[model samples]
Target: MTNPDDPRSLELVETELPQLRDGEVLVKVQAAGVNRGDLLQARGYYPPPPGESEIIGLECAGVIEDPGTTGRRKGEAVGCLMAGGGYAEYVAVPEGQLMPIPEGYSPTETAAIVEVACTVWSNLGMLADVRPGQTVLIHGGAGGIGTFAIQLCRELGATVAVTAGSAEKLETCRELGADILINYREQDFSEELKGKCDVILDIMGAKYLQQNLRALNEDGQLIIIGLQGGVKAEINLGALLPRRLTVRGTTLRARSLEGKAEIVRSAVENVWPMLADGRISHHIHATFPLAEAAAAHELLDSGAVTGKIVLEV
Candidate 1:
């Protein structure tokens, strides 16, 4: 449970195992992925959806300990995309949110990839329908989501551009097939790529709103998945109408069970093959024991991490 007075206070305490509802299974978690959202929850900025666990984790890889009403056998390894409760040793997951572990990936690796795979695929594939020969820009390209998105856009035969705060981070993005790299600390990404981007996967919200609009080409799409900079930006309606641009903001955690299930299914059908065939890979920047989750969150919050962080249970 989060402390009202001290948002960053995290402690391990004994709690009863979650009771499973219909079509849900109990998972013995092996590892859980750490995301920016988890840090927000820790700081009391983000909270779990109504009727969901208040535990601070969004995704995990584990074995089914109790299959509940689902037909799956116990002890099957699976990766779960969750609304909450992944930090615990055991979590109740709707069967539809469970994904088969990709071939050749361990529980740790599976944990690293599940949320990112589902998130990127759902936005880039389902929402934008990014096509080949397009120019895609991804902000925060050194982070887990950006790195994964770089490879996916490349696999789709699009030119990839990315922005990071440091040269080293930009280099990492380049190695992952990024065609253009802009160091946001030193360069103006909007000025550098004006009217060139066909699709932009943005994490910075209000701070980059106008700049992102300036960077897009006609019929361009700007998909906002995070608000690290801020929220509540003023948009120019005139610019959007003349350019035929689209700005969409989405959060996966608040989606319904059926919605998340569809994303999981589509991610498995499309992105899973890329993982299996080695067209894309999971990058785990660091790992910590569940007891050191505070340290893990601190490291990720530092903005120096190049990829995903995992908390092993």
Candidate 2:
């Protein structure tokens, strides 16, 4: 892909594949996921970490060309959560990052699963330790992570509350089993949810910090994964102390290979079966061909997408 001065910098050009490194496998990409991070990278704001490919993609599902030492043979369909380089016709990924496509999913569906699944598993499941009967608040209810988080939290026995900018999006969240729907545009979420949130999955960083704190129940955990609002915020230790609240932040793109590998392992062992058995589902908003990546980015920027946008390779 081309890195240019414009937002529409994505270009399809012929490139040669490299020889596989240790624990890496060559995949013939079928479909890949488009994410907000990819858009930031397009605007020259987010670059790949050292040793990662400079291409702009985070997840993909494809057939294995060379499985390397992963114990799986060639030609098996697998999905991967990548550091970068899922926007191309092929990608070289660590074997541990690849999960066999869940039994009933298509390539496009499988492509959308890995990144969001691992993110929710790492933050909500592992870090926050969300429990049965807990009240969880998920911001951005219609987005890729929000939709999945709603379903996963519901399936795991948590009562879910979600915030979205529109009614249609909130309705989608309702289908995913979200119990409380707060239209952020029309409602003050902090007022609607005061003292009701046991766990809050937040993306609007500084903008919602105080409100999120106000909404949290005692011993609440707030995990901030995106900075859509602002980057800086003030934490009221006085309020946090009385509630015993915990606030944490994380990003998947910057994690070490070992950390990502462990997340992938846990998802494969735990979440993959849910997907295979129809307990979990992938939600796609739209798809564009590899050459139409610029248009995909345009749609993402419009902020109208209710779920993930995919690119067919």
lDDT of 1 by residue, 1-313 (tens): 3464443467777789999999999999999999999888887889899999988899999999999999989999999999999888999999999999999999999999999999999999899998899999999999999999999999999999999999899999999999999999999999999999999999999999999999999999999999998998898899999999999999999999999999999999999999999999999999999888878887998888999999999
RMSD of 2: 1.4
Off by over 4 Å in 1: 1-8
Model 1: per-residue Cα lDDT at residue 14: 79
Tens-place lDDT per residue, model 2, 1-313, is 3654666767787777856888999999999998988888888888999988888899999999987776778898999988998999889998878888889899999888778999998998888888899999999999999999998898889999999999899999999899999999999999999999999999889999999999999999889999999999887799999889999999998999899999999888878888988788999999999899999998988989988999998
Q: What TM-score, over all chains together, does every model reach?
A: 0.98, 0.96
Model 1: lDDT of residue 157: 92
Give me the runs in candidate 2 sitting further than 4 Å from their true place.
Answer: 1-5, 69-71
TM-score of 2: 0.96
Query: What would you estimate as the lDDT of candidate 2?
Result: 0.90
**What's the residue-level lDDT of 228 in candidate 2?**
91
Candidate 2: 10-residue stretch with minimal lDDT: 1-10
